[model samples]
Target: MSARVTLYSRPGCHLCDEARAVIERVCTEVGTTYDEIDIDRDPELTERFGEEIPVTFVDGRQHDYWRVDEIRLRAALGG
Candidate 1:
């Protein structure tokens, strides 16, 4: 199966932005598809991940929260 990645973020969040950029660059290099989710737009997601805006998931599993670790991400994606 193809790898799936998702980023949970909100506007004006510096860490979120950084996480997105990291995901974009790594996903591009690793040939993976990713989607960004704005937690503010969803009540359940907002409640579950409000404090940790920039949470990331790979294949529907929580990969990281608050920050992006490139090495962990690469390993998760089998890079």
Candidate 2:
């Protein structure tokens, strides 16, 4: 089974970078698949998450923002 994760982010954002590292590691360890969407690519997404570029969603539900918790992510993905 694939665990789907969505990341709302933008270019040149340090926080987003950190979040990516955490998500990437956890996702890889758990065999979870993730989509990284640049909020700037979508007007609606930009308007909604512009201020929180590093937002992460697990199964379509918001999980964290600005920073990612590796342990929490692993638990969420049932890793």
Candidate 3:
């Protein structure tokens, strides 16, 4: 089964940028497909994850926040 990862982020968020970079690298290494969501574009997402702009989801479940835990993410992807 393929893994689907999603990154929730917003503009001007350094942590979010860092997390996205990490996710991009990991996705490339693991050959997984990922998408990034700008929470600011959606009111519900903004409200749900405003304080935590860099939330990550793996296979539709909340995975991490603030930063991308590479070890944990690798495990999640079965890498």
Candidate 4:
């Protein structure tokens, strides 16, 4: 099964990098994995998340943008 958490990001984005770290730490603690999609790879994605490169989705619903909230993520996962 795919991971419940999805991160939309692009290369060389400092905020994206920070979001990844938070997602990684939270997901690991919750015993779950996450999917990272590079927006730069898809024009549609790039347009959709142009300003919000570090967007995060939980359970197929948009959760956060530009940053990943560790406490909220852990709570969402019921960890």
TM-scores for every candidate against the unseen true structure: 0.93, 0.92, 0.93, 0.96
- lDDT by residue for model 3 over 1-79, one digit each (tens)? 6549999999999999899888888899999889888998999999999797699999999999998999899899888
**Candidate 2: residue 3 lDDT (0-100):** 46
- lDDT per residue (tens digit) for residues 1-79 in model 2: 5449999999999999999989899888887789898999899998898797799999989999988988999999999
User: What do the candidate models score in CA lDDT, each in turn?
Assistant: 0.91, 0.89, 0.90, 0.93
TM-score of 4: 0.96
Q: Which ten-residue region of model 1 has the weakest summed lDDT?
A: 1-10
Q: In terms of TM-score, how similar is model 1 to the real structure?
A: 0.93
Cα error of candidate 3 at position 39, Å: 0.5
Residue-level error in angstroms, candidate 3, position 10: 0.2
Estimate, for each residue in 1-79, the C-alpha lDDT of model 1 and write its tens digit: 5449999999999999999989998999899889998899999998999788799999999999999999899889988
Q: What is the C-alpha RMSD of each candidate to the true structure, in Å?
A: 1.5, 1.5, 1.7, 0.6
Q: Which stretches of candidate 3 lie above 4 Å from their native place?
A: 1-3
In model 2, which runs have C-alpha deviations exceeding 4 angstroms? Answer: 1-3
True lDDT of residue 62, candidate 4 = 97
Model 4 lowest lDDT segment of ten: 66-75
Best by lDDT: 4
